[model samples]
Target chain A: MISQIAFVLVLAAAIYFIQKRFGRIRKNINLGKNRDFKDQVDKRLNNVLLVAFGQKKMFKRLIPAVLHLMIYVGFLVINLEVLEFMIDGFAGTHRIFAPFLGGFYTILMNVFEFLAIAVLVSCVFFLLRRNITKVPRFFNAEMKGWPRLDGNLILFTEIILMIAILTMNATDQLLQPISDHYPTTGELFFSSLLMPLFAGLNESTLIVIERFAWWFHIVGILGFTIYITYSKHLHIILAFPNTYFAKVEPKGHVNNMPVVTNEVKSMLGLVSAESSAPPTEPGRFGAKDINDLTWNNLLAAYTCTECGRCTSECPANITGKKLSPRKIMMDTRDRLEDVGNSLEKGGPGLNDGKSLLGDYITKEEINACTNCNACVEACPVLINPLEIITELRRYVAMEESGSPASWNSMYQNIETNFAPWKFSPSDRFNWAEEKK
Target chain B: MNIVTMAEFAAKGESPEILFWVGCAGSFDDRYKRVTRAFASILNSLDVKFAVLGTEETCTGDPARRAGNEFLFQMQAMNNIQVLNGYGIKKIVTACPHCFNTLKNEYPELGGNYEVIHHSTFLQQLIDSGRLKFEGGAYKGKKITYHDSCFLGRANDVYEAPRALLIALDADLIEMKRSRKTGLCCGAGGGQMFKEPENGKKDINVERTEEALETGASTIAVGCPFCMTMMSDGVKNKEREQDVKVKDIAELIAEAKGLS
Candidate 1:
């Protein structure tokens, strides 16, 4: 009875903590300006189904894709066992599904055990990939301390959880005859292999080992759930929604600001232009801070897996430019977190002197981008770092009035000559007469 | 080749079937000017009524807009829209991907809507319609590789049209290791052509040119004027200019049909 009450209180605390952390993240993302992503339901649904569920983009690299697919499927499928554990933990019952499932329970337990082993094997290989082989993407300059450590930490935690699960089953299988209510889960295929190690232990010792493993496994899962929110592993949850709201328009099409478009249309007499007073901040044309960006942009930052696929494929990065698309998304999230922390600590009216521009992301980085859309194309979950880069570039050009001299000259040429070149538009057709 | 201006066509109380958007490079750059002439010659031969904007034509402001000078882009787009609308221009085609992308995608939201087609697609359509027949000419059995312009391929999803035109030309169409959707940039996109690139291990065009050279192709076929300039420079750097030629798809089609 005491153990049941203790389990209930710990589970309640874990749930409360996870809810609080998730709520804070949601609130932080909500701080950005609103933009409608309500269009293209059918397309978005298909994208989510393929990208998040099917892991479509992850299959680009064959070896790692197969390895990852194993772990991903194992992680999802084993969580079903976790559900059974949760019910059994709260009810203080032993193998509650065994009586109801009959022989199927044996099959189900065997599958879960097999997955736990696969998860362990995959986790070890992943650690080897990151630590020993040291894939170049994992060693990108931005992945210095916390990012690298977080990856290893998650792998280690998963390995520990798998061990706990296996040990619990092994001890439970051994003690099934001695314990009064323990159901006979006829030979869990994988865990039964470990039965020899615990066969010599007595009933009390086996019961202690089994209960401790059960406690450790449940607690470890709860802790991992909370830890993921604070890690790049947040993609495990956000990938679905982020991909669902991904931009489905033609990849090359730059979205025009409707406010600016309407103003241009009115100026062109496409419609009766509403003449309005321009008293306030006229040069505030692009995103200078998190608040200036749309909510989807904020969501993208939070959803970034820091997989470095975008950076690896970025033409600017490949050509040794200052820009790394991964870094752009990271900086956005960091600056957003910084601002959110400041606001949380200091009331609603308090301001943080630092902004996403200049303080976090540099002008050099944004300028180096070729706008090739390679980063956008490379993102597995449809995160678009180019959108944020363009927005920041827009800020540099409009708000700060800081474009390169060459670009300014080109702008001037466009304004005056109606072309990027100095040639008169009258001479535009002169090329047609060329005999070459 | 005689090219009629929209103004001349209007004065004659007639509208051409298409407006040939002579982009800045097509209008001014020496090598690209030949591409423009070739396309115009083909259109003339086909009797596909087309008119140039001539003095009234302006930059579509792709570079300006891409470089983040939205104000300049809006001004340029508005001016060009005014001229295009006044002339009652509907169908438009350009030999440049930069202009094709902006005119088709960007201009519509800025109140400058027109049916814009890239020259490769337009030429492909002409060949399909039997208006321009592709014959085995100088490029017969010649190994040619097509370089996708960023604005044309990934930006606008125009991977097939250029290939279709190349295959129609009866040339041995070879593909670079990275072609179509996964094509590399010519290192001259997004206004990088106008400025020195940021310090890198190598230039993107040089890398792309290496890929093209690896294909063992004699001709580096291109669709965008920017790509033509970049790929030509890449070939020259490799000292293969005397061997491998960088020709636009329009130039190839015009030659295939013996238009001029």
Candidate 2:
């Protein structure tokens, strides 16, 4: 009864903390401008299946893909054990499905044990890839301390959790005969192998170890659920909705702002189609702050796994520019967090005088982007970093008129001559008249 | 060869089958002028009725819009749309991918809608219908690699038309390592063509050029005018200008037809 009470309290606290963090993130994302990505339901569903569940984009690099798939598929399948653990925790029942499932339960636990070991092995390799191996993608300028530590923490946490699970099962298998309420089980393949090691240990001592390991395994998962809200592993949950709502438009199509289009039409004396109201404020042009960007842009930032596939594929990054597409997403997410904290502390976000543009991401990085959409393509979960980059670039150009002199000249030339060159529009066809 | 303007067509109370949008680069850039002429020559030889906006033609404002000047882009687009709507133009074709992309995708939102086709697809259609016969002379048996323009390939999913045209030339059509959707930019999209590229280890065009060079094709076939300039510069950078000639799909087709 006491153990059940303790379990309920711990689960409640974990739920509270997780909900609070997600609530804050959702509010922050809602602070951005409105965008309608509501079309093409069937296509978005297919994209989620292909990209997120099937791990389609991850296979671009074969070794990592297989390793990741092992952890991904293993973690998913092994978490089924968590359902039984939850029932045991809540109802104070041990192996509730054991009687009905019988041999299948034993077989299932064996599969889960094998997968737990696979997950453990995969986590070690991931740690090595991040720490020991000099993979360039993992250690760029943006991944200084916290990002690196967070990655290691996730792997270490997974390793420890897997170990605790296996140890708990091993002790449970050893203690099942002595304990009255303990579920009767067949000789499990993996955990039973460790029976001889505990054969020398007495009954009371074995129960203590089993109970301790069981508590650690469940609590560790609960803690991980909360920690993931703070870690890059948030992608584990967010990747589903992110890939589901991923842009279904042609990759080359840039969405035109209907508000701005109407404004332009009004200026052109073409009847404003959607001009229902006059401008609210003069300062609105493009994204000067996070608020000016679309909510989908904010959501993309939140969904970033920080895997740096984007940075690896970025032409600007590879060519030695300041632009790292992964950094762009990270900075957006970081700024959103900052904004959310300020808002929660009872203040307007922009009133804090910190913006995503200058503070987190710089103009130089935004300018370096070729708008190639390689980052969008490379993302395993279909997060579009280019959307954020383009929005910031739009901010700089429109709000501050902060384009470089050459671009300004090009703009002026286009306005006057209808071309980037400083020639008359009437002379547009002079090339045909020229000697070929 | 007869070349008429929209104004002339309007004056005559007549309409052409297609409005050939001579994009800014094709109208003014010295290098791209040849591509325009080649495509025009093919259109004339096939007895296809097409009219140019000519002196009334302005830039499609692709560079302006991509450079982040939304106001200027709309200004130019609105002006062009007014002219096009006034002409009652329906089908449009252009050799430039920038023009093709903007006019097809972006213009509809601004109440400027028309069936815009890129010249690569148009040329392929002509060939498929036997409207343009390929005699296959100089390009016959030549090894040619095609460069996918970012706007045409990734933005529009047009991987086949240019390749189809190349196959019609009776030439061995080879592909670079990064072809189709995976194609690298020629370092000239999103207004990067006009501005000097930001400091980098190497220019993107130089990297893409090295990839094209690795294919070992004697001729590099291109669809977009911006790519034509970039790849030509890339070849020139490698000092392989003489050995590996960069030609537009239209130019290659015209050459095969012995139009020059």
Runs in model 1 lying further than 4 Å from the true structure: A262-283, A347-350, B137-140
Q: Is the docking of candidate 2 incorrect, acceptable, medium or high quality?
A: medium
- What TM-scores do the predictions have? 0.96, 0.95
Question: For candidate 1, what is the lDDT?
Answer: 0.85
Residue A131: error of model 1 in Å?
2.1
What is candidate 2's lDDT per residue for B68-118, written digit by digit as tens? 777788888888888999999999999999999999998887778999999
In candidate 2, list every pair of residues with a backbone clash.
none
Write model 1 residue lDDT over A1-436, tens digit each, in one string. 7888988999999999999888878888998888887788999999999999999988877877887888888888999987887788788887889989989999988898888898899999989999999988898889999999998999999999999999999998888888777889888878888889889988999999999999999999999999998888888889999999888988888878666655666566676425544434443678888888888898999999888988987777877788899999999999877877776677541155778988889988888888788788888899998888888878888777898888888887777777786777677767766577
lDDT per model, in order? Answer: 0.85, 0.85
lDDT of 2 by residue, A232-310 (tens): 8898888888898788877777778666776777787777446646766645777767888888888888888799988
C-alpha RMSD for every candidate: 2.1, 2.1
Report the Cα lDDT for residue B32, model 1. Answer: 87
Task: State residue A432's C-alpha deviation in candidate 1, in Å.
Answer: 2.0
